[model samples]
Target chain A: MNDLARTIEALLFIAPEPLEVATIQDITGEGPDGIAGALEEVRGRHGPDTGLELAEVAGGWALRTRGDLAAACDALRARPREDRLSPAALETLAVVAYLEPVTRREIGRLRGVDVDSTVSSLLDRGLIEEADRPHAGPTTYRTTTAFLERFGLARRGDLPTLERFELTGPEAGALRARLEHADLIAEAETGDA
Target chain B: MRGTNPAEGRAGDAGNLGGVPARDASAALTQEVEIDLFQGPFDLLLTLLLRDEVDLLELPLADLVEEAVTPATDERWEIDAASQLVLLLAAIADLKGRRMLGEEVEDEPDADALAMREALVGRLVAYAPFQRAALWLADRLRAAERPRYRRVPPGTATPVPVHDDPARLSAAIDRMVVAPPAPSLAHMGVVRRPLPELLVRLRDSLARLREVSFDRIVADCDRLEEALTLLAALELVRRGEAELRQDVPFGDILITGTRA
Candidate 1:
């Protein structure tokens, strides 16, 4: 392969995050047009049908395993259910997740119990962090991406609605899957969903 | 001490006071007096009960009346006296209830005592939302309070021209947007082409024309597929079959007339 193609392949393989045109240029010492042309070539060679496909996500390019291969990847990386949080922890997490930029004082008042230790644990686990609270004496806390990953959420908005608490685990999961499929169908039909 | 007859002293005082009622005179005296006895309702009740030495089960109302009649201080004592009197009345009622019960009469303390504590808890509960609302209000107020002055420093870097007014600006914004004047092609390094057909096409194109427009040669291609194939062919040409122009904007050229 040409040096440009080889450089593009190396970038896709080693990039910690999705690669942008600017980043590719910086790495290959190429201009915007050169990098754009080279990426187009790389993408054309590896289409969606390939084992590894170039995907544009979050405003950048990445070489991702095809969507069909996700189940297999999940099977390989999946851990036992023993690490799941207890009911109390989940409840605390739900409140914090929903009302973030909330404080321990506010949470304690709502739950009718002091949550200092629980908040500390969440912070230690990197599931939540202390966010800025303007003028208030209390320091606000917010959920992190690790929290989303742990909960299998694409983003915070992917969190189950408050109404979902009435449903059983499998029922909720099935509902979530149906919603996701519907979203996919809609995105395919309209190009934006 | 100078009054030989108390009736004559009373008459002289009444005359000096301009026929004001005796009750009014006493009320005026109480108003002029000052006393720091009362703290709050509960504290005042406790103080009055202690002063009267009235048993909790048997409060002496007649003694309380006598105490109320006497003025205590020299100035501004009316407030203290009024609060004390109210407490005295409440204590009397409590004492009567205790007497009627004839035992320790362990009823719950006044709702006011517990009311204070309950109110404190309520305040604590309400504080969170209040603080959040306050923060939101403060943020809005701060945003509204910002000064609109544009005080550029004297020796600072001159402000760059915006595209909004191009007449005052020398350089075109479109030129800035489409960077670097021309695409830098030096980054594309020559390597071996894998496709046999692409190599044959390069030999064919090079033999037909001494030089060709690279973009035009791949213009018929729907996507980047043919362009990439053409790029691979050009790299092979660079390796052996043909030569490339090394100029300001390089284009593909054939050095040898032979078709591979």
Candidate 2:
């Protein structure tokens, strides 16, 4: 059991991206059942109560600092203060991040605001770039390597939970809750677990 | 009595004739009834506010409600009605505190509202930059265009069609669109060739052969699929059907039939 834990920890530490159970199995040469058990044990050892915990993100698992401790991590790293994202930029970024490889026209329609400029800023800041455009009029944009680097992510798949930054005013929260509930149902149908 | 009765009857007739016609009444009803301006409630509201030129800092909610229901503003405009209304609603909400409490209420705008306004302004400001970038990109894209079907040069062998008939080939291409073939491992796999054995056979074959151009041995084989042709050459060397010589720089290979 100790050996399994050590092996799992080592694999997680050196992994380029988050590891799935199947990936862990491949690396450790362990059976699925054994890997699943080991992962569960590791997760149990690092509960939410602790400074570090296991998080499931983008259909894979990674060891992450607790949400509450994010500020501390930021301080410890002495990371430069980032410019506050404007609502438009945030909205545009969210749309691009979630439905990535999306075109400017589609994003504009979604936000009810022209996104050409927002996309330019994002591109200029190396947060987004023109992905190959389909045979369509407008070219598509996708998040960039710098976006991941700025956010301390190895890839786009390392985005934190969408729930964290959801609009939560009275009217917005009510609508969001219903939408989230529907999302939960959908997730259950197609969840990785 | 006869004169009085006629005068009274004339007055009654005049009053009855003064009533509106049924068609005109229906028309009036239709004209007065308000239709929702746009699909999005928010965009419709913004349009109303913008049309009225109402300052965001002095939003008149009651007047807005009245204007929203007015039939005069129900006509479809150039911009999407829904989006207009959404923008109006956002502006109104943003200015709600200011409008209701006076400008000197020692209040700052809602952080989100201020952020949104800044972003919108930023987008407007960056329009020129986006246009410049887009124009540059468009020129680059135009310059990058290549001929769809490059003509095969004369004297060069026409490559064998992967699929024979054009119609069948097009259909196969369409099927590929729907379902792309998975990458095959055939190209990635390592092939073991005993170089020492090959060299020994080459020496043995050369002992009994006369010099020939290197091209003569591979003349019939496809140049692109070099692996298969090289394997065949190795096999020929092993069987004493070909020989390799160091006598020439580029034209070093020779072939001889065992019987010859």
Candidate 3:
């Protein structure tokens, strides 16, 4: 497009992580409006038809392979398979995402299970970070920008609404029974061992 | 302590039941009956009970408890499962006992018991949805799997020199690992001149000429001697034994013996 847009595009091309508008402004000495316009122009250059698109992730812009081409590119690259988040890890992440600045105690209490290992795993993965609290107490955790980027979410508000997961009286009963049954099966198997 | 069926190898069979994908009504309905049946599957019975089709007082839990506690062949009891069973059994017994006591003669149920149940249900409700949400996020993670470009830091591209000679390399490595020889101070000489001796010398020179240029007193002197002469002159001036004058900046200083 224009000169500023071209410069911003080149910067994005070289950046390892998504580059924020403020950072671009700092580097270019451009005002907010100018930077915003340039970013828009840069984004316009890569449409759905293009192999690479400018993705706005974690409040920053980055050029990445198009969403649909991810599998093909992955195959071509033949890189080691990325470690997928375990179900337990994901559940813990969801807990942190929803009830951020939450303590380990609260997460454990809600899940009705120990979450020490799970919480540490999420921390190691950079999906969650310890929140800074002025008052002294047990540590609290919250989802990080990395978490948003990984999940491809614009913000916490963009998470799917919880209404669909609400359980009716019968449904709740069924779920409880299911949990109990699973527990029973596990106990039986362990005893057999 | 009911015995387990290891021979049946039902562990593999259980995998088919899925892990808490309870949203599938048909699979849940079919698999709900296949697990253990306490008067035709506890889940189905619980559903009917919650829907008010079955009465708490008429649950026939005494027989269920007897069956639950009976020891089967070649089995051991796990405390967790036993404790869970006890809690469930106790809760059911409490509800039945309270209902039988005719505490309200029927209008309202026990608030404390209802609160406890509600709390348990509330926790499950809050947590279960997140499991599904996590799966959704995982799908998004899969979709967003594109390569990102990063700037290769400057000066990192140069390769480190390789030393092929083993003995030289070993010696080099040993040199690196060993503490370096204490820095040599043999080349440096410490010179100290007595201040009083220099003062006497300056006094003699200033007296011999009555008035002498300050630079002339230390003309052939080294740095230490010059520093000592300057200090001695300042001391003599402070004592009112001599007066020194500088005509301009960077000009020679003239020292005159006031004692004369």
Candidate 4:
């Protein structure tokens, strides 16, 4: 088990991007149960003593700079902007990413704003692409692989959950509950009546 | 890859070194700017904010917004590019005013204020991830990227069939209608052999045999002629001169001459 854990640790350490348990299993030929146990062991190995973190991002395991050191590692992550997208462009991109194979008209409805300039900018940037529609309806857009890489995501399915962000109806109830929980925590900390 | 601290600075260095793999041939037709001066107003503000490291909540967003918008106040500002930023400013003002005013009205907190804050917060929360994504993309773009020129000349796209001019589109449809109705199977003209002739051929062939296989009869014929023969055979069977038998539906059909 320790040997398996060590091997998993080394693989996770060297990987540029996150690796899935299945990918590790393919290489190691371990069952999912065994792989999960080994990963747990590997996670234990990356405890308080080390700066390297064995964390799951986008449904895969990756070695990232530990959260405590994120501030110090900003320089490592920071890179110059060549051609950046504006907030509207970025919002349009988010809409396209969340609701992929999405029509421009549909995106317009979701954003409640015109997306003409933003759509063209995304096209020029190679971030989002015009997906071919089988029927001659409005052209739908999908995020390119370039988009996944740009966002540091392994796949489109790895997009961060937007239901909470939508902050609508039932999701608002969840948010309210979350606020109540925070209030409880605050009350506990204050020792107030 | 060895027992080294491979965490120093190799985030996105592996891929095509920051080059705009322009592989787009038709891009030449569109006048391309060498480098975008700035992506737009929001990106400009983000770049400014990223450079300054100002705390978003504490910082007066209105000042930065005013500075950004002031240039555009004359004939300079683009409505498309800067409208969202202005709206953002309005939201910021609303939030700031609410924060100041709503604190005093703690006894009866306004629902509108909370809702406005939630809306703005939600947008910012949503916008934050994309901003980070844009930054990453921008970084990748900054890395040693060279635009690849196209080797082959770009082919002209077929003219768009749908046009705003209804007359022109209808004229195009009219032209299509007028043009020699698609030369259409004319070169291989139809050869309609009489059904009675096929019936006579079948009668002569099946006279000795108790039964004849439909496939074997049509095996030597071309597709069109073979189809005609099959139809003629079916017609003969329908007329009761021959009986059709198949052990299984869709299996090989057998046509036997009726003794009667």
Across residues B177-256, which tens digit of lDDT does each residue of candidate 1 receive? Answer: 66466777765754334467666776677778866555666666544445576575566666776655535445543244
Kindly list the per-residue Cα lDDT of model 4 for residues A72-179, writing each as its tens digit: 555545434457457677677777877789988887765667888889888988988988888998789998866765555656756556543443455545444334
* Tens digit per residue, CA lDDT, model 2, A124-189: 878788888657676888887656444434457454444443333553433333333223223323
Model 2 DockQ class:
incorrect
True contacts kept of each: 0.00, 0.00, 0.47, 0.04
Instruction: Check candidate 4 and list the clashing pairs.
Output: B17-B144, B18-B143, B18-B145, B19-B145, B19-B146, B72-B77
Per-prediction DockQ, in order?
0.01, 0.01, 0.20, 0.03
- With a 3 Å backbone cut-off (N, CA, C), the pairs that clash in candidate 2 are B42-B85, B42-B86, B43-B82, B43-B84, B43-B85, B43-B86, B44-B85, B45-B85, B46-B85, B46-B88
Deviating ranges (above 4 Å) for candidate 3 = A71-80, A155-158, A161-165, A168-193, B1-116, B146-260
Q: Fnat of candidate 1, please? A: 0.00
What is candidate 2's CA lDDT for residue B89?
A: 35
- Per-residue lDDT value at A158 in model 1: 46
**Cα lDDT, model 3, residue B2:** 16
- Candidate 1's C-alpha runs over 4 A off are A1-10, A18-62, A66-82, A109-114, A133-136, A148-193, B1-260
Per-prediction TM-score to the true structure, in the order listed: 0.27, 0.33, 0.51, 0.34
Better of 1 and 3 by DockQ: 3
Residue range with the least summed lDDT across 10 consecutive positions in model 2 chain A: A183-192
lDDT of 3 at B227: 84
Instruction: Go through the candidates in order and give each one's C-alpha lDDT.
Output: 0.53, 0.51, 0.69, 0.58
lDDT of 3 by residue, A1-193 (tens): 8899999999888676778888888789999899889988887898888887877788888877776775677675565667888888887887788788999999998778999999988889898999999899999999998788877776655677766655667877766665544433343343335
- In candidate 1, the residue pairs with backbone N, CA or C atoms under 3 Å apart (3 or more residues apart, or in different chains) clash, namely B32-B75, B32-B76, B33-B75, B33-B76, B33-B77, B34-B75
Q: Write the per-residue lDDT of candidate 1 for residues A80-143, one digit (tens) a residue.
A: 3435454445556767776788888887876667888888888888878988767868788888
